[model samples]
Target: MKVLLLVAALVVVGGGIGLVLVMKSAAGPEKQATKVETGDCVQLTGAGKEADAVKAACDNPQTPYVVSVKGTVKGDCPEGFYSYSVATPLRGEGVGLCLGINAQVGLCFDDIKTKTPPPLVNCSGARLKISEVFDKASYVNSPCKEGTEEVISYTAYGATQKFKSATICFVKP
Candidate 1:
């Protein structure tokens, strides 16, 4: 009788462990605060032209910018792309990333000209609204819709890597 009870208890505990493991796996990998994603938000630290980029949860009110493009070797970021360095900029050890205030359509920005990536704001104060997004960049002629008033493009260049770029279309709200 004692042996049977012990075996039963072990089976129950094993089943519970298996269930927990399954649940954990279904939830997917945990996101690190400093990790990079195409449309995830990040926080910038320091002052003026010198600053550091750290991944921040989109839910955080402070994280106003999302990555529009990554891994750029070009000397400068394309128009409207906010340049960011993953490593210490003083030593030039990190690759560059281009960021945007909104990751997709239906988002708004107030002061894109004066602010890098700008701060995502309510529609009431927004001067521009994101209308479209494309994976290509720098069209000789604007390919956006007739109402589009702003076009921003960012591109990545490396000797061996394939080219990558993104374009965003915006209109006055």
Candidate 2:
């Protein structure tokens, strides 16, 4: 009787442990505890669809883009960092992507009359300048390099209040 009881207990405990291990493995990727900081490399997922941005190692080839700035506003990216914004079709919450400075990326004009946004290109070594328009508060708060010329300005509406956002375009010098 003692031997049978011991065997049964061991089996139950072992089965429970195995079940836990399997569950953890099935939970998908583990959530990142650390907040994404400046200069960290990230991969933008679901492009041209729904955006699901996540942090990735700098050397990871899958994550080619770097975080130049961290904020909720758009078009307020620091000089040299390309700013791109993605919003749901219904104008729900939007996410911003601040590509690394001097990183070869494409450009899309907000005013471009098109059913979809333009494709990205390798605009490296191009004679381009930055044009930005954002909320005054955001502009004043962000740590953008000084002497950034502001070509145009406009009001940006968000899901909630009419918060300001900017559209900084790179043009030929």
Candidate 3:
């Protein structure tokens, strides 16, 4: 419900573009990003299944997906989660990262379900506006925002049941 400022740095690598978010905070000093783990945010290179994911600043509007379970098999992402595989220079094989929507309050998104990482869009005429997000099994009632048309949420069982995260996403009314 307060103002948060995002600070990122752009780095060019061999004609490709990469962004690193150095600091992020809300009404306070900037917080540094030092590590990557589950529940962290990621920036995708494209909207396809093969899109590469790089750790980005959490709560960033540009970073559409949040890491739900890292180090899992590719294509093992639970419902609402996407699978992204990355190759490490040191390893012969690729690593898998499961991601879900990085839905933040007040941010708007378009093509939420149709795209791998839904495109971020202007709030005006946007398809969805995040009012609040809740981890599954943690909430008891709907908390959608007033005048909201829908509560975005889902649950599904995967092949191996690696890590199924069902988030109760809704707006606070």
- Of the candidates shown, which would achieve the greatest lDDT relative to the real structure? 1
Clash count list over all predictions: 0, 3, 3
lDDT of 3 by residue, 1-173 (tens): 12222222222342243222221221122111113467677776633333356778776777766776777334576555566665432223445776677766776775555424566677887777776665553334555445655565644346654333444343322
Candidate 3 pairs with clashing backbones: 143-171, 144-171, 145-171
Runs in model 2 lying further than 4 Å from the true structure: 31-35, 45-120, 124-169
Query: Which regions of candidate 1 deviate over 4 angstroms?
Result: 1-52, 56-79, 83-98, 159-164
For model 3, the superposed segments whose C-alpha errors exceed 4 Å read: 1-35, 46-51, 87-90, 135-141, 153-173
Give the least accurate 10-residue stretch of model 3, judged by summed lDDT.
25-34
lDDT winner between candidates 1 and 3: 1
Score residue 33 of candidate 2 by CA lDDT. 15
Question: What C-alpha lDDT, on a 0 to 100 scale, does residue 167 get in candidate 2?
Answer: 40
Stretch of 10 with least lDDT, candidate 1? 26-35
lDDT of 1 by residue, 1-173 (tens): 99999999999999999998887676443323235656566777654334556787665656666665666335466666677654432333344667766435777877667525576778777898888878777668766889888887766556543334667888998
True-structure Cα RMSD, model 1: 11.1
Write candidate 2's Cα lDDT for 1-173 as tens digits.
Answer: 99999999999999999998787666433422124545566666565445545777655434545555555534575443556555433333455555542222233232222222223333453334443323332433543345643333223334543223434434543
